[model samples]
Target: MTTEQLTIFAILAITLGLFVWGRWRYDIVALLSLLAVGLFGLIPPQEMFAGLGHPAVITVAAVLVVSRGLLNAGLVDTLARHLTRVGEQPWIQVATLTSIVALSSGFINNVGALALFMPVAIWMSRKGGSSPSLLLMPLAFGSLLGGMLTMIGTPPNIIIATYRQESGGTPFGMFDFLPVGAAVTLAGLLFLSLIGWRLTPKRKEEQDTSKDLFEISAYLTELRVPKECKFAGRTLHDLMAAVKDDADMSVVGLVRSGKRKALPSIFEVLQEEDILLVESDSDSLKTLLDVTSLVLAAGEDQDQDQDEEKKKKKAGEWNLTEAIITHKSILVGKTTSALSVRERYGLNVLAVARQGHRLRERLGKLRLEAGDVLLVQGQEESLQSTLNELGCLPLASRGLRIGKPHKVLLSGGIFTVALALIALELLSATTALVGAALAMVMTGLVAKDEVYDSVDMPVIILLAAMLPVGQALETTGASDLIAQALLEIARSASPAIVLALLMTAVMLLSNLINNAAAAVIAAPIAIKMAQGMEASADPFLMTVAIGASCAFLTPIGHQSNALVMVPGGYRFGDYWRLGLPLSVLVLVVGVPMILWFWPL
Candidate 1:
């Protein structure tokens, strides 16, 4: 190998090592790799950052924003409503949920489809008394399988299509992937719904109880009805009814003039300065505050100055933080009401958790203890400072935004139009998606501020950063050298065997690196191998497409897998138990389908 090829190979080796290390964020690793290549002069400095504006990067960002718009329009809630009508049997639920995820992923981004359905799968698991692990792994895997069915389903397919077009051949049409992709998807889905789910670890269900499932609900705290609040005139029952379908909170008690009423009557009308004790998760707290127009109570004292300042700040400017009460916390033995958390710290205690146990007492009256988890809300800077002063360690966030269901039709329609544009070849995928995203903002389906938050920056960075590295591989002749070696190995084997081996190699590489990067590197090699053997390039390219999308052996292989890890309580080793068999099934089934559909 030339010096440049050697340098590229060494850089790639370290990059892959960092990816598997899981110490640093993948995007950071990718960015460092991009900079390394630039400094080494492997890639020209002028073109080093060009990947950021590539069509694939733009398309990925646009798709993510569109997915968030669909989510904000309550698309998942609509699906959940129908899902409840499906039979409650575990196997049946798995089949139904996985089927929906897979089908949706075929058209939309696979990670977005998985995110939309993850909660539904968890709910189904809870309702059926099954381990979420059993359902989640299948749902994640199904999303991966579904991505193979269309050009836009996954980034790898888009990369492969672009590669084919650049090689002086007509780009693969949207449905060209359907035949082999469908076959592989069918086989993989069958394995997941039937045999694969059975292989998942049941540690979650066996070790965790229903009480642990309700841990997220422990973040509830009380807010006082201000004199100007609209909810002051409404009865407790009426207020509950108003937010029943959307907000995941309930009125548990009432406090009038510093005295607590543990079980206030449903018909009791809320009064000015009356503290309505509410139970809600962290996510719904902001919505609850907005809907009721109630001010967060610090204590018996109503600070007019603080309330006015809070009212001036935009709703989205506030931050919700989850912190663990440490042993040295001054408020450990005191209740929220007694400690006057809001009065003392200028932070609102939105919810509290002590181990896995539920606090049945009033939120304000419940005594704080060391090791308790508190969901506190305030300005970002103040919240962090308060956590430090109170001796608490912050935890990862958990909550969902409650959005308008009325906008579902509009958002879904816009998304459909974009898909139609791509299908009819009226617009390029990136242009169509960008147009749809802009339309979503224009129609108020997604808010202006939320557009930036909707795009997955890490994913965008990872894709953009890896593109230049992939190009460097091609320019250095490393891809050609690898392809020649593979061709030599396949010379003694049949063409079908060669196709299967090529796919198997790519599949292994995909499991270790980003699937899009794998596709970019492997596409050229597949093309080179086909040319060397004087065989059809179509089958070889199809093999690369299948291999890149079948990254099931490890969670790091695909974002869909990483998305399910924490929620499903999965370990690093948990994936291969189910993923291994499904991967083997893909190779066993995908090769023949590719050959049969596009002969060598």
Candidate 2:
């Protein structure tokens, strides 16, 4: 190998290692690897940040902004609320939920689509008397399928189209992905609804409180403070000390002489026969009872005022909701006490769950992370606005608000016109989407101030920084070197065998790195592979595009997978169970479809 190729390979190896290690953010690791390229004088200094202005980058950013506009206008929310009525059977609910999410993913960013529909899936699981695991994984996989339908649905498709253009071919049009994409999506959807869901682990049994969004029966319990209890005279805050120091729980309510306090003060003093409505998140329930001398008791009805007028005045007095923290959540990386949730918003952080288990740390000191589901207690009046500002997605099905008719019309209208222009070849994808995004701001469909916030900066940076790195691989002939070595192993085989091999390799790599990165690095090698076979590059290019999107094996593969992990209660090993079969099915179903459509 040449010196430049060696340097590129070294950078690639280290970059891949850091990605798998996950010690730093993907954006940060990508930025550093990009600088390493510059320090080695690999590329011209002028081209180092050229990726930032690439059409693919611009299109990605524009799509994200457009997604936010749709969300702000409540288009997806309205559709999802109506879509959940597709019968209550597990197979029907799974089929309906995944189908709706896939269709939505075709129009919007996959993460945004999954975010809006995931709550619906959770609600369906609760309503259908099944564990959420069955629906959540299918929903995540369905978003991946939907992304294949349109070029604008995923970053890999856009990047692959750009590569096609640079290779002297007509760039793929907006609907070019639809023929093979739709076929693959349909087959995958059928498999998931009928057979794939059975592979998903049923992580938890349905709780008795069927209406609750998340299963937390083990996290919640009732205890009675007796006269013989040594801590009777002590404050509730003091009683909290008797519980594990690190574990998190809350006294959500209390009963004193048949009068219940919805939110008992932490400073409230414990008394004889006081029924403490406690929530313990740890496995220390038995230990807590033994240490505090508290006895288990049945909870009583907390029906408040009988006065109709008084009830009307306090219509939203107390309510409980489950909220999942988004990547954009302002609450990320901070403690609830640090934000003073109670003091600032009249909300209580009753409990928090991470990675399919309730956290055992003290809630006050437990720092927040993206994907942590929190059971929040607050007044129903201001709950929606508070969660919005905090960037939390409430799991309640009714959290979505249908916008004014005009706003919805304008939001959907702007996007549809943009797509029409792209399909008609009147405008490039970048130009059309950027125009639509700006129009959203002008039309009041999206607030101008929040436009930048709506864009996913980390993904943007990762894509932009890695673009030049991918270019460097092709320029240095590193991708060709790698592709040729594989070809030598399959020199006597048919092009179809090579195609399947190439897709499988990229699919595995994507499970380790970001899908867009996988696409960027693999695009050139695919062209080389097609050239070796003396066949059309379109088939190979499509293989890489679809392969990159098949990040179903690992939680870190795609944001959609990671987003559903905790909510679905899936462990790291759980993914391959469902993902393995779906991937094999995609290969079996996609190769024939690609060759038929693109003519290898």
Candidate 3:
């Protein structure tokens, strides 16, 4: 091999190794690789930073920010609140939740859609007395399947379309992927709801009543009413309703004059210095206190009007409940001190989920990752909003979103305009998307600070770094070598077999590597293979796009899988049982669909 080839191979190997190893962060790895390539003169100095400004990379980031706006605007929340129900049968709940997530994903980020419904799914499972494991995996897979339907649904489709542009072809239109994406998503959803969910391990129902199925700890807490509290003069019933409607808190009982009252009457007048035994978590309670100016009475204070009046302005009395950080969050690499999560989003991390794993140091300094459930305490609204912003799926059985419900049309309209422009080819996809993101910001649908907060910087860097490497491969004729090898192996096989083989291979690689990386590496080889076989390139490319999206076997394969890893309380092995079969089902259904739609 030439020195350039050998050097390139070594760099590629290290990049793959580190990404799979999950020790160093991906963005760091990408940045280092970009630097190495530049130092070696593999790419021009002027073009070294070009990947950072690449249209594809920018579009991905903009889309995420826009999706965040849609989320904040209460688009998904309004729908989810209506669709998610209590006391339904497992199948009924699963069907509703899965269908909603899939349909929602076609427009917004699939992971975001899943995150919206995760807490609701937990509520359904607990109410129905079924295993959440059975339900959540299906919900996640449904989101993944649904995202395949549109250009904006998943990053893989966008990446492939961008690749097509670079290779001198028009990118796939918004609905071009729908014929195959819809077929697989519909069929996969059917099998998953019918058979796939049934195969999940029955851990939720089998767990002891003492332990939460998600393994999160619940706490009892007291809220002290300051003189300024909206509830100070209101009766217990009115206070309870107000709390539920605005503050995300519930009234467990009332405490008056140093005595705890069990189930106080709704008409009981809440007064200053009265202690309320609220059942909500620290985060929710904090938000309630912040909004209503309530305090957590730490001491046995029978202190009446004077002390309560003096303390009314102090905002620090909000109760602190603990939450465990799951291993699956974007917060894995950050710390409370470093990330300034409390100041930035107004949530405090009270503890970490070692999960029987040893902690080397203080919890405050430890960086979090997927499966590390957090024990946190904060204001209810801020905490819930923070959870949504961080892309951390909550383990609690409650729903939360951050927009006025009546503004749904505005949010949907903004998103629709952006999508329509891109879909109809009136503007570049990147321009239309960026325009939408700005609109979301300008309209106050999403906060200015949240624009950057919603995006995964690591993903951006990975895509940027890998783009150059992919270009290098294409430029160096290495893709041709790999494609020739694939063609030689598949020469004796029927075209259908070749399509299946390519799809299966892409699927397995996606399970191992990042989905975008898998696509970046595989798309060119697919094109080359199709060229050599004298076959329609569209089918082969579509096969990779579809297969690369079928990251059903592992959490690492898809962002959506990792999003639910801890909230669902899943083990690494837990995914395979449902995902493996679902992947097989997709291949079986998808191959034929591809053959029928964009025949090889």
How high is the CA lDDT of each candidate model? 0.75, 0.84, 0.73
Highest lDDT model number = 2
Q: By lDDT, is 2 or 3 better?
A: 2
Each candidate structure's TM-score, on Cα atoms with residue i matched to residue i, is 0.72, 0.85, 0.78
lDDT tens digits by residue: candidate 3, 295-353: 87765452442245224314333323323344435576787567766446656454455
Q: Name the regions of candidate 1 deviating beyond 4 angstroms.
A: 204-206, 209-254, 258-404
Q: What order do candidates take by lDDT, descending?
A: 2, 1, 3
- Score candidate 2 by lDDT: 0.84
Considering only N, C-alpha and C atoms within 3 Å, which residue pairs clash in candidate 2?
Answer: 247-360
lDDT of 2 by residue, 532-559 (tens): 7777889999999999999999999998
Summing lDDT over every window of 10 consecutive residues in candidate 2, give the lowest-scoring window. 301-310
Residue ranges of candidate 2 with Cα displaced over 4 Å: 205-314, 327-330, 397-406
Which is the better candidate, 1 or 3, if ranked by lDDT? Answer: 1
Instruction: Mark the 10 consecutive residues where model 1 has the least summed lDDT.
Output: 395-404
Model 1 over residues 344-443: C-alpha lDDT tens digits? 6666665665543334445666788765667666554466557766766554333322223667788888988988888798888878989999998898
TM-score of 2: 0.85
Q: Residue-pair clashes per candidate, as listed?
A: 1, 1, 29
Q: What is the lDDT of residue 487 in candidate 1?
A: 78
**RMSD to native for every prediction?**
11.3, 5.3, 9.1
